[model samples]
Target: MTENLPFIEITDIIQSLANKRSTGTLELSRDGEPTTYLFFREGMIQHLKAPRSQVILGKALYQLNLIDEADYELTLSDYAQTGRRYGEVLAELGLVSEEGLRQALSFQAREDLQNVLTWKQVQTRFHGSSQPLSDVFSESDLEFELQMGGMSLLMEAARREDEWSLVREHIPHEDDVLRLSAPGAIKAEDLEVRITLLIDGYRSAYEIADAAPCNTLECLHQLAELVREGKLVTLEPLELIELGHEAELDDDHEKALKLYQLARSRGQDGFDLRRRIARAHHMLGHKQEALERWLEVAERCAEAERADLAIATLKEVIELYPTDLHLRQRLVPLLVANAAKADAALQLRNLIALAETNGESPQLLTDLMNQLLELDPSDRPTLKALATLHREEGDGVLAMGRLDELATLEVEADRLEEAILAYREILEIDPENLNARLRLAESYAGLGSTDDAVAEYRGLADILYNSGLIANSINWPFLIRVYESIVELEPSSTPAWEWLAKAYIENNQRDLAISRYLGMAQSLRPTPGEPPSPALISPLARVVELDPTRLEVCYELAHTYLALEMRVEAGRTLRQLAEEALRQEDVPKARSAYQEAIEIDPFDLVSRRGMAALHELQGDLDLAFGIWLLCAELCQRVGLLSEGRSDARRALAISASDPRALKVSAALEALAEEPQAAAALLLRYAEIMHERENSGLALEAIAQARRLDPARVARHPLLSLLSTGNTPRSGAPLR
Candidate 1:
């Protein structure tokens, strides 16, 4: 005998007996359920006896048409009196032949095995009889003729197990009753007549299988098909409750609640039913219906004086919604009404703590905390709340003491932000509380508030510095590390960068100081369209001071100067950048630097000359002449006539016949009031244009020369061509 084996072990027990060729009866049983027996002869199944719910042999024989209903009833009565098997009685009366008896017996054994396989747990016992098959039951009983191979029956059971999963989708449970959805809608061929006759809205699928001609799996499959076709459906209320129970057993609370709610809509109601529904809702997660149902059950149980039940129900809800202040408050009074003083006090304490932390109104929280304190004066959470109230009321001296205590508690609880806030309050009450500030800083750093932490650290450093720690260099390294963190958090913090740099220098790591500044400047590269950052200035300037040949650094420094409206300094920096770039033979870099310098101060003659020289080096004569002319124009505008004349001469030297150069040169000479020199330049300009067939331009130039010096223009050779109307393709009109 084997006890408490898993349901799957039935197959192993059957196979082991078959392999051993043991002749015995295997009894399968579960607690609170009927036992099933399988009789084997030479390891082949010959007979089975299962519960009436699982197998009704006479009804199965009648349903399979092996015997008529009359024959089934007649044989059952005769077999009872004759002390013979029902099938043997049927065969004796010729109601069912011997072959029919064997077939019915085979069907019974298959049904029994299938049902046994579906059970979740079982106990088994094998009684080895050691008797011949004919002697086990008399030859007249015909048990010897009804043998089935054990392995083949087990294989059939396995197939049914697989198909049961699919059949279960529509017919969720075997005990679920199925009925015609609309009697007129069901056609004759849609379902077998025998099965249809059993669908009286009262019989379960398992019962229908026993009373129908088909096996259990086939009957279930047919019912599922009818369900899918909408010709049949599981009966409501009863079937829903059954399914709910099944789901509940499976711990599928959501499905159980759905099915139970469906049953309630169909008029299934009771106190226990509603309580079960409430529990399902609670397990599935709350809906308003679930909450109301739970509340109703709790109230009913409380009125019934079932305090334990009521308390347990409320406790379940509270566990799910711990911070629900109203729920906790309600639970507290319920515990008190139940005379559970210890539990009541614990709940009250929890309520007070929750109110304090759950952002309840200040008045309500104050009342709760005061009540808790009255009962238990040493409650830490209540004390913390009172201290917070004192701080808010501006009782600083009293608040400071409470806040220090609160901060320590919060730190131990690992609530770093709360601890930081408490420490901040302490510092507010006593601004020079270095200990509080230090704790606050450390907590801030722990919570990733690096900038805030560094700010507090700097405050501490300042307090110490004013106390003359800096004179002895006692905390200089501390000062350095603090500033390093500050800059690390915000690389572009100007003051932090300066402090770090100075700290590095005092530590005699000047190169490291320079590297830090350089790193800072690199991090501050300005995005396009954004205003230049002020923080970029000192770092870039420092880096430039360390190595002036850092042209890119110098270039950014120049832009920062321009942003600050320091035009002279910007121009100076750009010039330095251009000189350095030129020394490196980077013509493009030098050109850009000079271009920026000229943009900052349009009349910067030195940058203009440098740009002009770079253009000349790059074989760009036109650009060179243009820059020279622009320089001369700027000089004239600024009242530097000699400088203007020199720039103009430079332009003419680049392109002797270029009209723009000649015009600029003439203008500069006129600005210097040298009429002859101006006239000569204009005449030269006119001659070059006339030779290029630009007679109109030439005539305009001659007109300008005449304005400068009329006598010199009259002596020009172009004047004779203008008089002859031999002006090229276009006639010229002198202005």
Candidate 2:
């Protein structure tokens, strides 16, 4: 809520000392209707819940302090929970003259939206010690901070001439199409005026936004939310933007080249324009030309003193450009040098999600982060990135420093355990960091530590409990594990037996983990909010599916079905879990998630990639390999190749080769194994190259040598003799 905070100021907060925390809302619009939005850094507008009407919107805003004191509190007492609009609230109170209510209505119509937050408009009246803004709230609530800082931003932005008011609801949106209230409410008797704008039609959305000080974002977000909710009915645009700079060409390459020429000659031939043309060049069988064009865009953007723009354009170029040792050697570190301020966090969020979505190379992550760290100086993210890079590069101890700082700041910032592992990492260094030792114990317990994980849970428990604290949230799973361990050690603690039973149910192990749940179920005891356990589901269902619920067991069910492509069964199982969550009041979100039985397999890759696991489990390598091959192929087709490669290599490691993979690789032209087939394919390629003299003699020679020694060929012995039959091949005569 500070005035005129520049983008640089936001970055300053991003780079601030002592973790200056604020939840950001890029104020999209305040003109349309009184609505708020939640947009992630990934450029996704997740939810757009709006007010029921303008009067209700104004009332909320008045209460939050956009209105003068007299207007806000006067009608406040007369407000009814089940009542209608604010103008009516005023009528009931009789504080405002009829003229005043009409005046309010007039103002409401001209103003499109009012974003409101409670914390910003008023300070806490509670008397106590001062605390960090974040510490004043419950662990479960983000509202305190939102009300304080976020709320004012909403109000200020709402009062803006054209932006949509940003509002926060107690409940996050579960529906794709959320209901937002318009700013003006008429009496129910006034049927014509009572009609709220639909805001669903694109034309309607634009008109609403245009009514006052408008931010395109509010409209965009509403559209995004509608699209997410299945509420958005997309109509084909009457005027689709077409390529008009140049006429269509005979082929893709000609089209790309012609487009590039046209842009350079006529269009907005800046970085983005040229970059787009360069990308087309790559796709249209002109890779070198594409690279050159991208380089040209980068050079131009750089010379124009638009370094940030240059960085973005260059990154795009890097993504499209063919990666090579020489190019990557010069390119990777340079990308770091050119990356813009605050772009790391933004890029990481966008790229990781994109990488996840598109199944792009994870090497992209490594490269981007590494450059970010190297280029940026002492920035927290940069420092942390350095730490992650070290750990990823097998320098765990080295990473400990960065992880430690991150953990401290993260914990101080109330980030939970997202960074605490770094604190535990210090253990490997000090082996006696008693403070870190205690923190590590807490961390392990937080991670659902088993009894055998470490022997210090009791110590941690004793310390916290004796000191009159909550004892690390009394994690029932960890307690069960501890009790189970005690049972193993002493074998007959009645307390252990009783606690284990209770813990079993809390830990979601109904039938097997504790037979006592079933025993308790038959007792027909009401367990708090739950129905008498026996009637919850059939006792028959419990008895029907009782096996040790190993991680593998959970996965095997999901994986086997997926391996067979049983979408209905997969979706059914997923839906049940989702429905269970829904019953728990976890709203159905638009994102793919697991409900009762998670059909979404975050851990299924393990079962599919049985590398050492297959060996260790006394399972068949051939079967595991078959499984991995199938999963890899399926995952690859779905653009989950990183998942595929991890599994594929694990499977490949079992026997060092798979001709089928080679064939598949041969078909896709990306797999780098089974050199005999690959080499044979290359030989054929070389002959074509030599006959056509593709590019030049240098290209033909390169292809010939490549058949002998293809670069980055996966380590397979056959690749060694991959040349023409010039050397003795296993049993073939030496030439």
Candidate 3:
């Protein structure tokens, strides 16, 4: 710093410090040595925290909650800015104010506040607080006390003086960014920068002059630049401020005059100083002695409260002299009703009432009235708001007593139904009001009301449904109990039956749902001892019983039995059902289903013929013949159809003699006459005759050809064809 300029003079900041208005921390320097400090509205230095540079950066950013380790590295990376204050960068970063930057620079300039404050009023140190800076610091806008000499000397001046309207700083680094510290600015390009090469730590500011050989002032100019950018920071050492003497004051005298005129003048705001004073007296066992002091505070606070300064006064009392009983008691109900803790508020209430005051003020009674209003809770719509409030405040037994009294009064007023309704309301609000449900049910039962009793039971069911703790085995039993009462009231209830079935299903008893329907199906059964004649099951009713799922159920069951070697039983059941379908004239179902049954027992000739006859009635000649052939083979195998195949054999024989059979025979013979590929011709005719169910016809055709021309018939393909005269037994034996 220039030796010609004096160090920073602290006398300049006395008034703002005393009034609790100026806040941000401080830094000072002297003789090129950096010192760090904090100035609070609370007056006493907050903390000297660290060296000037670190603390200055920390406190400024701390105001913005941005001083985490992350921001320091970010700022260093971008140290060059077109001319602007460090506080502008801080403002852009939203860390500090334009007014704050001016004050910081002015403090670093050792300026007078009246002079500093006057200069501020005369010229805008920063962009208007609201207009907010964007860029540019004008030379006309800033005038610094030139600290002439070397770089280090100028840095020293920047730190010590607390006066300057603006700053310009020079920074050295590998890469640079211009940081504007004003809140906002106008076209900032005219702002200037001075970049320097940082020398090794050993080099003094004089060496900077050597490095800048053509400019001796380069060192001084660099240091001046650094200061403007807020890179230089330090604090002047302190000698405490004197307010007034405490020695002559009487401890018990009137407070407003004595305390303010003497002790509080130096405090940032008197409340903070008064708190420490109260604490000292409190710790010294001067409770009654200090009562007079607390009374003055409470009186000041009460006056503030009456003037609607309640929030500030309350904060002062609570955060400061919190142990005062009169103050706490007066404030507790206000706090509680406003959503503060009730128990803490109550503790203060109880303690204050117990205090040994010689005589109470009307304020005390007024406090009691408010507290009582908060305490009473008043009445309610359904809940008796008072009782509900207490219950919610966690006094359940108290709630119960209130309800009991209500119930008694209701009974005396001959409102039994209302009393019952009240009880029901409780149960509605908390359905686990099992005692009420039981009492209500008994009341209904006393009046011989089954419907009311049933309603109570259903309410219990709703509870069980919600809780899910009803025992699994007993659920149906409970449902049945409700159902019995329901039916007792209305005998023809379909919904009751449905609910019972659903309950059975929920318990996984599928047979129960089907059993009732099955009994209906079976009641239509012919009498008890008679065989199940197909006539016994009505076609429509049987259709319903044998629903799609039931059809699948029986089909799957049969396959399972077949797989388990119970083929005969599977066949018996399937054939009977298929025959039943045929009697109903469901021809396709009878044909295919009986065919499948016959397939399960290849030896059952009757089963096979029964299938063939159904197919024939449906005009499926090929299918009829195929089933007939299977019956013939099965019968012949078991020797059952060798002679008596019932109408199936007769029908098959009749169809085999048809005129279409003759056409098949003719096609086979004409195709055999093609000599070049007689084998291919024979095979083609065989496929057609086979598809047409003329295997018998094809055999018979060979017999006819032999009768016409023996050599040709004998020479035809197939094992039976080679036997001439004696007809090789015709037709494939059906499977």
Candidate 4:
């Protein structure tokens, strides 16, 4: 199907054909351009041909200095005479090697495809064929034919088009002249530098494009980039005049002077132009005729309601005649009435600086400060000067208030260092200001001034700690910084050390946390022959409580608890250590941990079970079975029937003939609503117990089985004979 380029972009069409694995000759053409044919084999681009252009393989080779002009001419002559392919002739004559010819042809094909891809407006059609056609060069001759895929071509072309658009923005007209502004700004080997050397003041962009070493589009794109980067300047006809007029209108006299100099080269000399030029010089602080011209222009601009332009015209005059107080008087009211706060502030600051130099009255300075404040309430420099002025006027409260406002504004603006200075000024007025001190500390920390932050935090800690206001609160992050700084300053302080250890844990510094915790433990250790403080137990225990998986930390906690003679805590810590070890499958470590727990609390059944489980994992069935039996018995004594059943199953797994395990299993079975299975298990258990000379227990087991299914027991010959002499009731004890 035929497709329009705009509706489906050329890249999308190419991608679609590739995805469909279409094999055919795809023809692309644009109006007024020769048709280009692309041959595809199994969706991969095999070859491409375009109407002959100067950028063909032979010319490319010559341009790249790979083949001499003589060789190129000779090869062409040979091809014309023999009617052979150009690359084949080049290969046959050894002007270029087979590989070199293939490479050149590949480059030629890619360049042809790239040229086609840049066609913004084109028509496309695919001509399907059942059989592929043979071209000038066989596949064997050009084994390295361009394999540029659809996606790669799309990306490259899109990138070039985007860059071309940006370049066009800078060099919009082909008639624009480009000249180098900064010859030394770019490297000598840079493409921009080479392009810049080609630019002369008289050559238009179109002429430069024709003379470029590469393709016309690429050369134009490079020239545009150079213009945009300010390395090159585009000089269109009358641009200087337009710029000069613009500067003159904006009252930028300095810029106007520069523009007018270039504009004058175009023969723009007239009385009115010379007069404006003189006025611009005068506004730049020049003399005599310039000064007269500037005064006239300033008045004319003012009458035209262009106050900004008039003010610009007068600023230079005021600089040349600083003693001209009348000129200053004229500019000040215009500045204020125009609502030009920035310009007014500058003029007022200058006036104040001049007055202060001349020893002007304090009231005059106060008035200037008030004017600056009215212009911009949050102006930092103005507020700073106002604070100093208010303090000198014996208004300390007002001065401190201004400093506080300045600090707040600075903080909100993310000007951390500026806020720090403002807060320092506030503290200077009231050294005991807690809020200012705290803000200063926070700002220091925000700016990564760690040592300064630490100092401020230590000072705040002293104040808060002395007031008894330092307690655990939701503001733990702030308190953490305070205590951390305190510990750094007073490493031996017990409270600070304790709190810092907790802080480290809270901050997720696992390594530092363990170290700090150890330090606290050592500091809280009692002297020889003295009982450790009960308070020391909590921090030591906290280490394990924070991360029970830290087996080493848990071990240390247990040892410390033992040293403190806190037996119960010691046992608990060891049990936690053993549980953590078992969870990690560290059998040897678990064994040791459990053994220690048993030493601390010999009746710790959890530890005993852990040891048994460890033994079971090590394949020691006898030991495992013994421990499981003991656990089962203890659970049964405690009325933990489910746990007893679980342990009994473990023992039965080790030895199916064990009477105790069989009895527990059978009872559990009965509870589970499987009387038939329970009775069979009990009958087997009674047999085992009787064989072991445990007749009473055996009879008890048999009676339990009978209670489960009396009829089934009566039919079983062996069980009936065993119970015949006893004739025991369901509730009777065999013994």
Candidate 5:
């Protein structure tokens, strides 16, 4: 095992680099843990990369309240599209000021450094670069590099560690709860109100630290101080025990053990508590004391007539002590008496092995094997022994039954060759056993013996057909070849023909697929006003796939896809059909196609846009406006705000002077929570109305803008002209 080095040694390594003014990347790694990378430039720590634990800049900004959810999501979307750094994206989006970013970056660095200082046994390597960091890192990565003095950071870390050590006695664990000694008692000497308000006797120190706006280290230190001053206290031992029980129930044995130990040290003790402690130990690793305690508990449970609980306790002990012969010997009879014969047989087998290892007599071996086989017939050793015994006695029929069981087990274990030999033996004894023959065929298929499997399946298929049960036997994949033979033998069999065509499709021989269906379609053309033949669905779809000019076939394929509940495929088919309809100047057909496409896949942008266009061409401006606005809202929801804006612009273009259109455009901007953008669009609408000398509409637009941003509306240049009932002197736009 690698021993932990002193923390001072790590600080010294970093300090020596600062003293030498070295520039490089220092990588720290530990066994089975993620590596940490620290970048230095002219002796200053510029960046730290810990893939496992680094706090991303965007998350830091959000945690610090420097950016809200809407802005953060938009920044992520913009960053993903542009491949830019998060800090750059935040600044580009104008969501965070320079100072705010600086603070967030510093917070990120401090949090990462705190994590680094906790590692004491990491192997370190420094790759020195002759080139400056500006050249070494990409511009995007270097643009927001943190400028932290290495020695100063080390000193600060050391100071925090020292303070934490002083407070460790009171706040030894993050989950240690703190409550006010007297409720409503204010201790304002040095504590922040946020910290005091969070001391509601429920939240742990880590939770309080997370809930507060301040750094974790500072919040923890304040909480520790409160405990030291006797103004706060930890949870009582009983309460701690309750928490440990809760942790145990949650399957967190490690945490539960720690809490239990802490409670024990605080003078909590009882027989039931000791039993719980023993169970926790057993669940964790089955220590010697835990085994002994559980054995004692099992005896007491038996004395109390709790057979189920006693059996469960003994089973737990046996799982950890599988080789303890006495334990299994004791457990087998109990399991048998409890009507758990399967479990009893398993334990009895273990006992037999222990007896053999101890040089006990083999006199009971046959009887034990017989009993085990009665409970689990698939037990390989017992089945093998019985088969050998029956063969030695010349009882071939009884021997074949044991062989059958062994063959099933071998097949389940994927020992197909062994299973095949056993099945061949069984067939020799009973040549007409169709079940064995079917199993042999399936085994051949499983082993990739396709030709052999096909021969067997074909024979079985012929027999089943003569027996009038072929329909029930053609479901296996290997039977597809049987269907092929049937199609050749009976050319007039429609079901056989259909099955062969489907098999051809599955095999990707699409050119050969649906041939019979195409023949049927050709033979039976639908008369006028009569429903099309159902068999034509496949052929029509195939025709549309081959030739896009088959408009009627395309419509039939769309209906077929819908009937099968394949809506996505149906929507795509309809969209293509709509595009073709538009090319043919069939406006009504195009509109119906687009409408069907939208109904199937309401979020499909292409169909919605096509439908909106059709509505516009048909002189239904109101219907067109609703679809365009819906498209904008959908785009915004998917982080395509720019596309959403374009959609909103399309809506505005439909009816520029419509008040509802202007308000709808403003609402799209509000989706991004940008009141400024929303108010600007409203103001732009007001300006356009004033230029048209429409005072009433212009005032209405100004009133809507005021609702979004009163200050911007109050200071607008056109506000005075519209209020005084005069057109703007110049039509210059208000930005």
Candidate 6:
């Protein structure tokens, strides 16, 4: 048995003992906290005791609401006065029955075990003893012993820990206070409701968790859920400070600053406030603002005893005035006083960079580099600055040597790739350096051996997807190569196939992607009771998007949909195929496709259009005209005037005297600025009306033609005699 808990987990220890059917006591301790003891009898947890008073069986009963507060107080008093076990005291006082006491003890033991499992930083020791913990358990208590399965406890603890990690993000600080936003509107289960009712604006989340009837983690999890559901809200720490007692304002500079920030946001402004704000900023490591604000009151920050602030302010000011050596000279003492050696070195390096930018003298830059190296002898930035200085002085050999040293340092710091790139730079200068080539190859192999290229490509894909560039034609070639590589390396990879299919669709290779997906689906043999894989559905859908005219793809898609018992989707795909067939003027195919579509969805428009188109193609003129008229009316009713006009034209081409067709065609012709065409159509309408013995309507149609084109109507033989109430002779050419 392991005596100490260093790297070993408590769960592992418990599970090992249970597997071996060992009998002993396990003790766990943390510094300044009382030790927890667990007694096992033949691998089962016979009893457990938590050091915390909250885990006592009597307290657990009170928390669980199995006993009232008065009963709990009496039980505690009797146990204290008689030195009897708490469960015995509860049974003797009749506060709880033997069965209720047993249940409470079991609950208490589970809570203790859960708490013990979370003690990752604590010390644990196990002692193998022949004697049972007779001191802790009486004979009657042994009869109702709380036996917990170690494996179940371990699993529950692990689940709770995972849940706690998510919950902690929302309720990050224990000091965070939450208040009920809408007490009346919170509709939750009994446990959540109980936790919600405990939430008051004054209590911290930790307090609410402690006061709830469940374990602390369970209470917090419910609280986080309530917050997400908008039934509760967390109060900011600054807001809590205002709601707190007045004495909280003194001594704590951080809290005072928060209060002042709140005040400023509320429109409180003055010079005193600014000074206080500046002082707070200085004390809180906001170095730049402290100096600027102090300079407004005192000419120099040194007068305010904040030399660090002065140095930071000078750095900021020097960025704007790089040639100001006096300011740099003033910053030196403050930098030394503040122990800012690296920052001092950085300031000198900045001056050197500025001198290079302004094309200053090399001697001046050399003096700056020497001063920088004096402050921090191994400053890489200053060393690089010196290297630049040497290279500008036409010292190529010295510059290359400096770069070699820097690369060696990078390698020692475990930046192998950066070192390799530096070596490549040397080869760029020399070109025949075999050592540089070997090192670069070694670095490349090292990175490739990690097998993170797939992950890197996945990350790149994510970036492109987020940036809305994943579907860009320019990125398609690179994305295709990445996805193909992943699939080639990991042949059974589903995500790779999905990404590759997407790339194919975006790159206009939909048919190829569809074929690949169908092959993939054929390879998968689904379980007897399960649906087909979603991977099969994606590529089929992409094919339809690419070209809905592909009846073969539609057939495969519909079959796949039917295999998944998705009748509605299957019907939709069939309708797409039927519409595409109708568009291609394949009458027999359209008729067959429409029959199938109508069987799936009787009211679908695709089937209606297919049937109408089939009738028209078969030359059943009257029946076709009637179906076209119905289609026109449907289109017109749905505000599709262009489609309505097309249908009406089709009907008129089949039968010249179709009433709806003539009316729609005449109107469309007038809108198209063809007044003579309109006049001719209305004259034909009049002839049709005249044949039906509707003389009044025939005269009305003639009047409409005259209004459309008076000159054309006068020239028309049938329409010219409209005012005389005379019809044209039989077999007269209206044209």
Candidate 4, residues 592-617, lDDT tens digits: the string is 97888888876667777887888888
- RMSD (CA, angstroms), candidate 1: 24.3
The digit string of per-residue lDDT tens for model 2 on 12-80 reads 222331133333333322343343322222222112222443334344334333455466655454455
Residues 590-638, model 3: lDDT tens digits = 6666778868876666677776666667677787776555444444444
- Lowest lDDT 10-mer window, candidate 5? 1-10
TM-score of each: 0.33, 0.22, 0.20, 0.33, 0.38, 0.33
> In candidate 1, residue 567 scores what lDDT?
94
As for TM-score, the candidate ahead, 3 or 4, is 4
**Distance (Å) between predicted and true CA of 729, model 6?**
99
Misplaced by over 4 Å in model 3 are 1-110, 113-115, 119-491, 503-735
In model 6, what is the error at residue 610, expressed in angstroms?
99
Location of the lowest summed lDDT over 10 successive residues in candidate 4: 726-735
- For residues 1-735, could you state the per-residue lDDT of candidate 5 as single tens digits? 112333346678788889988888877777767877778888998876666545667768877889876787887887789888788888877889999998887888778877787776768777787443443345544556788888898888889889788668788877777788887555577587867888876567877886665667767887888788888888887887888888899998876776776777778765456567778887788587677776677776777777787788778778777777667766766787788998898787787677667765444554566667877877887777666666666777887888889899999999998888777777777665677777887788778776666666666776687778765544346556676677667655656666566546545576566564454345444577665555656666665665676677688778767766778878988998999999999888889999888888879998999988888888898899888888987886787777788888898898776655566667778766778889988887777777776667778878877888899988897887777755545565543
Candidate 5: C-alpha lDDT: 0.75
Higher-TM-score candidate of 3 and 6: 6
Give residue 640's lDDT in candidate 5 (0 to 100): 78
Worst-scoring 10-residue span by lDDT in model 1: 132-141
True lDDT of residue 352, candidate 2? 42
User: Measured by TM-score, how close is model 1 to the native structure?
Assistant: 0.33
Give the best candidate by TM-score. Answer: 5
TM-score-better candidate, 5 vs 6: 5
Cα RMSD (angstroms) for every candidate in the order listed? 24.3, 35.8, 26.6, 32.3, 32.1, 33.3
